[model samples]
Target: MNRDRSLRYRLAGIEIFAILLALLFLAPFYFVLVNSLKTLGEILVDAASLPEAYKFTNYSRVWDMIRFPTALRNSIVITAISVAGIVTISSMTAYRLVRRPTRFNNLLFLAFISSMIIPFQSVMLQLVRVTSILELRGDLLGIVVCYLGFGLALSVFLFHGFIKGVPLEIEEAAVMDGCSPYGVFWRIVFPLLKPIAVTVVILNTLWIWNDYLLPVLIIGSNKDLTTIPLAVTRFFGQYTKQWDLALAGLAMSVTPIVVLFLLLQKHIVEGIASGSVKG
Candidate 1:
């Protein structure tokens, strides 16, 4: 009886601790949301306190100042196209590597894995130079192509691990049923990859959506191609920080991605578990 009581107490304590930890992590979001409704002076004077007057105009002003609609459209186009390319190319590459463990394929897989370790910072100069030389700089295609190249290694690695767990007999059965290789892969293998694919989409979407640096470099001086992150920078200049407007812009920018993550969050764990077990 005493041991049972002790275990119950321990579990209750753990739950309480978890709640506090969650609140700690959520504190930044609290500040952002709260300050977003305040005036710049109010935010500066008492950032943690509630607004005396909720200046909702901050959002409207930020929206107009940043040309939010244009930025939103640019972000959507780039993220969607880049993620689609990443998913298609990575899955196909991973499938081929798993199906054919030839020396060349193995070497190629290693090369992809190795590339993942190279930091984007290290290649920034080269990236800018190469894109410029190819006349890809400042074009929509430029940023999309860069995203595809950088995103491929990690996506392929994830897909590779998950695909290994798939049974070879399934592919064989499809082949015997007179399915072409393409049909076997697309109809049979690809469908089974839904969990990992969703995971890939979510991860890459978050990365590409929030990304600022890549767009700055590749889409330089192109106001039409400005993304959310880039647009938000208007609130911060050399010395001044428009906290109210900046926070409002951040709140607006984060809402869609947050909704997306919450909706699909369950799949993240499922995909990782499935991949680890299968690999």
Candidate 2:
């Protein structure tokens, strides 16, 4: 009876701790949401407290200033195209690497893995220069290409791990059934990648959607191609920051991705866990 009571107590303590930890992570969200409804002065005076009166006008003003629709369209298009390219290229590449396992393929796989360790900061200058030379800078294609390049290594790594778990016999069976190599991959192998593909999409979407630095570098001075992150920066100037509008823009920026994450979050854990175990 005493042991049972002790175990119960321990479990309860763990639950309490988990709840507190979750709230700690959620605290920033609370502040962003609550203060977004307040005026700049109200935020300066008491950001921690709820506004005396919610000023939803902050969102309206932010929407117009940031050109929310254009920003949203840019972010959506870039994220979608980039993620699709990443998935298609990475999955095929991973499939080939796993099935072939030639010396060159092994070396290539190692190269891909190694590139992940190289910091993005280290290559930014060279990337900018190269993009300028290629006339890729300040274009949607430029940013999307950059995303594909940077996103490939990690996506390939994930796909590689997951592909290992897929039975070779399945591919062999498809081949024997007269399925073309392309058909075998697209019809057979690719479908099985749905879980990890969802993981890849969700991860990259969040990264690309919220990314500012890459867009700043590649889409420089192109107001037409401005993403939400770049658009929101208009609220913060060198001398003064519009805290209310900034927070409102942030709230708007995060909503779509947050909804996406909430819907597909289970796939992330499931895919990663499965990949690790299968690998």
Which 10-residue window of candidate 2 scores lowest in summed lDDT?
Answer: 233-242
Model 1 TM: 0.91
- Residue pairs in collision within model 1: none
Question: Which runs of model 1 end up more than 4 angstroms from their true locations?
Answer: 272-279
Q: Give the runs in model 2 whose Cα sits over 4 Å from its true position.
A: 272-279
lDDT of 2: 0.88
Q: What RMSD, rounded to one decimal, does every model reach?
A: 2.2, 2.3
| TM match of model 2 to true structure | 0.90
What is the per-residue lDDT of model 2 for residues 127-235, given as tens digits with 9 covering 90 to 100? 9999999999999999999999999988898999888899989989999999999999999999998888887887787788888888999996898998888877765
Q: In model 2, what lDDT does residue 56 have? A: 96
